[model samples]
Target: MNGVRGLLGVAVCTGLAGCAAETGYADLEAYLDAARTQATVQLEPAPTLRPVPTLSYGASALRSPFQLPVGASVADRQGAAVPGMNDPARVREPLEGFDIEQLQMVGTLSGTAGSFVLLRGGGVVYRLRIGDYLGRDQGRIVAIGDSRVDVVEVVPDGAGAWLERSRTLALKTHS
Candidate 1:
């Protein structure tokens, strides 16, 4: 009885091994080939590059930074009243020490005598009127309007003669 049972177990194992060997993988191979045919691959085109532009620098048209600004001389022209030109010997005013661009017309004041322009600069407010001097370029107040102060500045034209230029200092409005 023991020998018969052992023989039956060996026969069942042999039958399973034979069935596994006969099984085919053709269906799996056909599925993988179909997936590869249906798949698509895309590649982008390369970007075009532009050439850099060449710049030409001309020094003749540019002003010299080492020298004083254009029309900075205060020498009097051959024949002109040039109010501030002949005043070199006189005492310089307090506001004359600062540049014209640094000063700002903040507001105005009126008194019994006349109206005065209020200039603020260097952390201090200054009251000035017509004929008063301000700015390093011998700038003199000529007219005071409602919102602006007109001034005549005498500056050198890079030569021995001086030139008079009109400048306006407007009241600053804050937002």
Candidate 2:
């Protein structure tokens, strides 16, 4: 074991001595310095950004797309009254404040007077009957069927006349 140890030590010392010898590349360093000095780095110029054109909206006279058209309602009022049309002087109902689209017919109720349409809106349920107003436009409840309620809304025709438009709200069943 002593002899083997001595041989291993000698082999390690020889390996280390070989590594200690200088491996010269003095010409490579001089060449790299010369090349670096001679080389010129050219960068591309930054691209010019064009100014964005300002847009002017000229649709003050036009009706907004987000809102329902008021022309039909105006024309309806301006035009002559049609038979079975609602009276504008009648007292408005609780559900009349909300838009008809926002109101949902959830169910129906029958009473001695007549059948009533149950409308749900703004987290509250309201019972509406015939002649009850329920839309942004003076939409009066004309008829109440088993699963639908018909409302007649007065709208303006483009030709300066009022017209009656029928709108229905179907019953919504929840599972």
Candidate 3:
């Protein structure tokens, strides 16, 4: 029995020695060495930052947005009263009942006597000359041209004063 055990132990030792001498990992080790030599590791460069421009706001001298518009009454702004602005005793004319915007210049009549402007308002035609009063706001005709009539009106400025406003009534051309 001791001799049989010695032979089995010697056979096991011989099989292990043969396996150690012929290892199958030689190809795998060669492939790993080749891959390591061909491999590369690179890092990208860091980015650069630019400086921002400094801007200064320049609207300190302008009017504030929270305040009202820069406008005052004619009497308050001018610091004086307009002479002969609105006469209360003046007689009203036929066209004084209508607004100046409602009157339309239809035609112009020029004769040996003087030139006249024909206006149509409220389905009625009227012949107006320079210095004639019209419109509800005491508008006096100042010029009567061939295609238009200009008037100066005295209107309240909402500050217990009157201001002269120029209005033009253009001629009505039929298509």
lDDT of 3 by residue, 6-118 (tens): 99999999999998895689899999999899959687877887888988879988887655347844446457555444567766789999988888899999998798999
> Model 1 off-target regions past 4 Å?
1-81, 86-88
Cα shift from native, residue 34, model 1 (Å) = 34
User: What are the clashing pairs of model 2?
Assistant: 72-155, 72-156, 73-155, 73-156, 75-156, 75-162, 76-162
Candidate 3 minimal-lDDT segment of 10 residues:
72-81
- In each prediction, how many residue pairs overlap at the backbone (N, C-alpha, C within less than 3 A)? 1, 7, 0
**TM-score (all chains, Cα) for each model:** 0.54, 0.50, 0.53
Candidate 2 ranges beyond 4 A from true positions: 1-79, 82-88
User: Residue-wise lDDT of candidate 1 within 1-175, one digit each (tens)?
Assistant: 9999999999999999998884688899899999899958677878888898998888968887756567664443355565647666888889999999999999888889899999987989999999999999999999998899999898876646678889999999871
Question: CA lDDT, every prediction?
Answer: 0.85, 0.82, 0.83
Q: Report the C-alpha displacement of residue 46, candidate 3, in angstroms.
A: 32
Q: Per-residue lDDT tens digits of candidate 2, residues 1-175?
A: 9999999999999999988987787789899999988959889999999999999889988987755477456445465676534666667677768888899999999979789988998989988788878887778888999999999987765556567899999889891
At residue 167, candidate 3 shows an lDDT of 92
Query: Which pairs in model 3 have colliding backbones?
Result: none
